[model samples]
Target: MRVSAKSDYALRALIEMTNRTAERAVSAEELGRAQEVPSGFLQAILADLRRAGIVRSQRGQSGGWRLATEPTAVSVADVIRAVDGPLVSVYDMRPESVRYQASAEVLQHVWIAARVALREVFEEVTLAQLASGDLPDAVTARTAHEDAWQSH
Candidate 1:
């Protein structure tokens, strides 16, 4: 359930790109500066996104970076997976692939359920909604709960 720094930075950079009106490519440096992420780390993230088909890179004077698809087609889950692998992993393995002893046999179900819970939100939100600041009703409803903001 922990969100990695790479995922956060990637989402921030993508959101910045989604908000921009310019048709020009966005340099890694510009994305890093705009999102307040480290330049080198951001470069690696951009590369990952490109390989994941979440983004496309251009070379030469007018070359930089851009989303490979429309913002609405790129969900938060997509960005997270693009930069950080699976949304949830049990010991770096898929939840269903993990085995547990009799005492903890039900733990696998918990992990699978957690993955589903994450998908319920992350997969439901897109870069367009995030960049436009017009979140889906389901997301807004979750945020409206006072308990959602308080740290346990």
Candidate 2:
């Protein structure tokens, strides 16, 4: 499953917010700059995040955005789902929801397995773990694989 730019940027922005010690609201501009994401695109992603209840926005001079939930409670899967919908889809349909012909009967299982594999990583990680740079052993072990850093 390919990770979308939206998910990457959303996670970056969330991590930045979590890293900041200030209680002040974080402007879209600040977040965009912090992650080096285009301000316009970042704003749209932030809107998705807000709508998902992952973030809260404030108004006025002191108003901006902040996490609606604790960092530790917000998983990477949550951010990805909030920004990009399903983790894995076959022909735009969910893996389990897709029906296959006899020849491709096994394809659905492959896609569903892909979804489960992605969840094993994303569902296991939280914004706090990412921001702290103290990833769990399971996450680190995945990194230990020599092929993990190789381009597909």
Q: Against the unseen true structure, what C-alpha lDDT does each candidate score?
A: 0.91, 0.92
Per-residue C-alpha lDDT of model 2 across residues 1-152, encoded as one tens digit per residue: 78899999999999999998357899989999888999899999999999999999999989888999899999999999999999998788898999879999899889889888999999999999999999989989999989999988
**Tens-place lDDT digits, model 1, residues 42-84:** 9999999999998899899998998888999999999999888
Clashes of 1: 0
